[model samples]
Target chain A: MTAPQDNPQPKLGIIAGGGALPARLASAAQTAGRAVFVIKLDGHADDPALDEYPNVSTRLGAAAKILDAMRANECRDVVLAGKVARPSFSAIRPDWRAAKLFMKVGMKALGDDGLLRLVGEELEREGFRLVGAHDILTDLAVSEGVLGAIAPDDQAISDARRGLSVARILGQADVGQGCVVQQGLVLALEAIEGTDEMVRRSAKYRREGVGGVLVKASKPQQDKRLDLPAIGLTTIEEAHLAGLRGIALLAGGTMIIDRAAVIARADALGIFVLGLGDEDGETNHGV
Target chain B: MTAPQDNPQPKLGIIAGGGALPARLASAAQTAGRAVFVIKLDGHADDPALDEYPNVSTRLGAAAKILDAMRANECRDVVLAGKVARPSFSAIRPDWRAAKLFMKVGMKALGDDGLLRLVGEELEREGFRLVGAHDILTDLAVSEGVLGAIAPDDQAISDARRGLSVARILGQADVGQGCVVQQGLVLALEAIEGTDEMVRRSAKYRREGVGGVLVKASKPQQDKRLDLPAIGLTTIEEAHLAGLRGIALLAGGTMIIDRAAVIARADALGIFVLGLGDEDGETNHGV
Candidate 1:
């Protein structure tokens, strides 16, 4: 093995899942003058943008192949990016490594966060340094304050605060990451249905007068390296279609995918995007 | 105010909401030779069966009218039956009684159970004893063990156990009443969108192999007198369409609206209807 001093900045290996975030992270690493390798998850990492990167496609359960691909490319720093859905217990045909990991966690890994933690641990134990996508794309993390031209009114802000607490409780239970609150009533919650579907369902339960606010946050015991809550232009479109007035994301904890485009769409649609203060820091009522 | 020695049982007052339970309760009370008065929730209690009952239709916020009618008809016992969606803060134009109750509970009443408790307290304070629908329709209360011809297999029973805990946590938070679990993965949770919608949403996320199980239970701190989780033909139809294998409801804590019809339909559709044992009593894992 080469001395640790031989390569202070090792090649980054990105295990790409579904969405544009993985492609963006790969680009960011290249822009930083560092070589990168991409392990595209079969049936999930279908984004054409990933084609430009040096990558190999493999099934999610093929852990041995994934580890070998990263090692062959001389990648030591690994980043798991995008959305990797929690595989149903019977659906996953785990490799030896994956089977071993599952044996350790068993049914506890059935939860989304639990499964991610197991995957993160496996990667670390294989001598690969786990890196969060946000580490490479700093600008993508939501900042504390309002985005776009629209600022939430008192009513919207109040709804957002209620939604924040509800979202946190959901996360704490490891049940969901977001919820839509309208006029102090929770309209819809994100379970396995996901955020976009939850947003769509919220439209059916909206109250009179004002629309709801979409609140997104990381779970209290979240492993940030895996599945940081994210929003993009599609989120803006869905929220608009669902008649939501604004979006509230936990500042520094949520990822704003294509921030400029998302903000521009929100501005055009007259919907506010407010970054709630860190849960560990001062309470951000958007005051 | 007649003396207690004058008459033993006063007329039963049912503040009817949506669904068949109100009408069923009305019939059950009449069959028992007890006089019944129904206060039909206008725009909500639209069941044609309710037309035969001695009733008055009033807006949800018109608590004074509802109470006055109940008093005029000498309804000393009240049962808040059927589904009442928590009204948006601005949507409710509360009368003196409702306004006072809201002022007392503040936004605490925003939750389903909280709102029911407030309504129950107001009824008690006004000298009417609150009754549960299950108390009126004794046969409707689900009993332990398999209800229909088809019994849940071990896999289905395991899914139900996982779902029961998830549903309990959701209830403890006053967020929902049910959840769908498939192959050890939570597919959907019922929030303001209600149980049928949650069941419908679960279909979209079903994994391969065995279908999911729908588990319905009263919230951990559920005010059983108000909204004990109820299911009927509609629930059966929805679950069947969603490709669910069976349903497990909290025994004695959930009301099976038209028990015979629900069972017949479940048997006809080849789906098992299992009643989990009472939460406070024996652990009924369907072993």
Candidate 2:
């Protein structure tokens, strides 16, 4: 696989997904002296921002264009960043290349994980190294320890651990990346409904029965550029509605869109935010 | 603790919750020449029909009543059988005994295993021995081999194994006893929301291009007779909508409620059903 020349700066491929993280990762990579090859999405990403990253060539591509974009730029590693409004099955418009991918891989492949894993393999077959987002930007990786003044009670800690485990299982299979746990029981798991809905649903558990722990983590063998599990100020705000005690993220694999803002919100809400360390730190769905 | 008299038949304590299982257990025990004690439930159990057992005694109380009835009955072996609606936070009417229990145990103690462990300890303290339902009705325990004519595909089996682990974790934690898995990814984790909701809500995954496998199990410390996870005709129906491929449940330990009916439904739906031999089962939440 050809590595983008050690121009003291790498050309990274950002396979942007839905959300603000893709844009953030774009700017971060550029600032760090790396050019970005962005696969700007339709519903999931704001395309107008393409003008912001000049050296970063952008394409609103179908599958062929996507692979071509990465190959043409001689990109080193790819990262999945951001959220896109996940269209129901009827909505996914797979171009011929994407369609061919589906036919080659077949419907039997697992969910998001399968889609990513297959594409990653295809990219490698054509010569592109797939790098986990966690391996890059260690400086931006979540730092371990409570990022707030308050600490979790015993129950919250237990919930957080369990939540992390469940979330990882979901991640490993590419179902979702977050879970709400309370008193050792899982309350809700995020799917297309997303994180905010899960937070609102947790309110039902609040009647002193069993409170919840919210955990978000990265999946095993996951590509970081398309959709790095992220949390921001809004996540903190949602957690407050149901009195979530602990908020957990994968130390290296996950992104906090605005770390300072998230921490500040957590501090204000008296919620505990923690970046669990790597490898074992992230829960594997044991698939 | 003192053991029961050396009679061939043992004395059984029916720590009834909200289901018909306790009465069924009592009838079974009496037929085997044993004595029975029915600890009636306040909100969950149907009080009238429990009078069938000749020596049955009833008491309406919260979680604490389970232990007390076992002690009063002078029964050496006790089975906690039946369901209690998940008490909303406001509905948690633990008496002084249960209140004391809550005050004493922390979050770790709240896990399903912990709660059952506590129940087992409390019974031991009161000189009652807690035994598995399978021990009493081993005939009812589902066998390990596939129950229906057809076996689930490899993928469904994979999903089943994954579901088993997740179900065990949730069950051991005293949360809920069922989970739906697909392609090695968890589609739903049951909590107070229960099994039915777990199935219905799985539509999102079906649309995401993956069907699911369903699993139900008893906790390691599960006491039989009360709230053993029971799946019946309705389960198969729900699985149909969610595009489930297989269903697994503990054999002897779990009740199928209407076994024949559930299996028939599964047969028609092409959903594989296996009464997994007693690795355990628990409270089924849901609509």
RMSD of each: 4.6, 6.6
Report the lDDT of model 1 for residue A274: 97
The interface root-mean-square deviation of each model, in the order shown, is: 7.7, 8.6
On a 0 to 100 scale, what is the lDDT of residue B63 in model 2?
A: 55
Report residue B30 deviation for candidate 2 (angstroms). Answer: 4.3
Q: Model 2, A221-251: lDDT tens per residue?
A: 5656435677878888888878777688777
Which 10-residue window in model 2 chain A sums to the lowest lDDT? Answer: A278-287
Error of 1 at B94 (Å): 3.2
- The DockQ-derived docking category for candidate 1 is acceptable
TM-score of chain B of 2: 0.75
Task: Please give, for residues B226-284, the per-residue lDDT of candidate 1 as tens digits.
Answer: 87988999999999999999999988778899989899999999999998874532233
Native contacts, share recovered per candidate: 0.47, 0.24
TM-score for candidate 2, please give it. Answer: 0.77
Report the lDDT tens digits of candidate 1 across residue range A37-133. Answer: 9999987897899989899999888889999999999999999888777776655678898888888877757665677778888899999999888
